[model samples]
Target: MESTMQLLNKALSVQRAAAWVEDMNLSKSAISMAQKRGRLSPVLAGNLAIKLGENPEHWIAVAALEAEPESELLTRLRKAANSWRKL
Candidate 1:
């Protein structure tokens, strides 16, 4: 699964990402933190996915999975997210 930083890098430059965060009324530091941590909060992920014309649910699931430690549930949810992405 692609990290939020990966998705952002694919769709926008660092400057553009920061500008987008600002446009969303969020601090530019949000983008910086996601880049540094290689993750995003589910809400931010959903919003970013929408801005990039991707499925928000898929990203929301992915972000949720990433926020937690590995486990059977995470694996199952990852599979479900991948399946949802195919739709």
Candidate 2:
């Protein structure tokens, strides 16, 4: 499980965090908790994937099978999303 702070750090864009908040049905605080010892559901994962420019359905499928998240998975997701944006 990722800490809220970690997720927040990983969120390269406020748009990413805002999108997560909206889709997860979570308040910023709740997202914070989720980041700290909380699991990101397939829906949430799909939302992030969508934000990253991947097909939501494609990630949703991956989310279904890959319920548990680790550093490796999260890293892959993060890279796939490429949260970084040049201003």
Candidate 3:
């Protein structure tokens, strides 16, 4: 079984994570939607105590604390993208 913490909010940037979820090929609109409506933030945040699942601010704070370093996160994203290509 996978730990919830490891699986949840794996990407600090919701836009990046959304891109990953959206087949790892980034869409500009996906980024814009996350900024405008925070459509992806809570899905990334996962298992929060907040009433509304779409709390972008809380998502940002948690992501900052839980996220891997920038280089590491980018590497992970890169690996995901490549894996998608193989599929």
Best by lDDT: 1
Candidate 1 per-residue lDDT, tens place, 1-87, comes to 467666677556534775786678988588778878888889988887888788888788778878999899878877877766566
Decoy 2 TM-score against native = 0.40
Tens-place lDDT per residue, model 2, 15-64, is 56567677657777655554664445566655666666655565554545
Best by TM-score: 1
As a whole number from 0 to 100, the lDDT of residue 18 in candidate 1 is 59
lDDT of 3 by residue, 1-87 (tens): 022243333443333445454644445564455445433443444423132244445454444433445587667765665543333
* TM-score for each of the candidates: 0.75, 0.40, 0.24
Q: All candidates' lDDT scores?
A: 0.77, 0.52, 0.43
Error of 3 at 81 (Å): 34
Q: Residue 67's C-alpha lDDT in candidate 1?
A: 92
Tell me how candidate 1 scores on lDDT.
Answer: 0.77
User: In what order do the candidates fall by lDDT, top score first?
Assistant: 1, 2, 3
Question: Model 1 residue 80 lDDT?
Answer: 70
**Model 1 segments more than 4 A misplaced:** 13-15, 79-82
- Residue 51 CA error for candidate 3 (Å)? 14
Q: What number of clashing residue pairs does each candidate have, in the order they appear?
A: 0, 4, 0
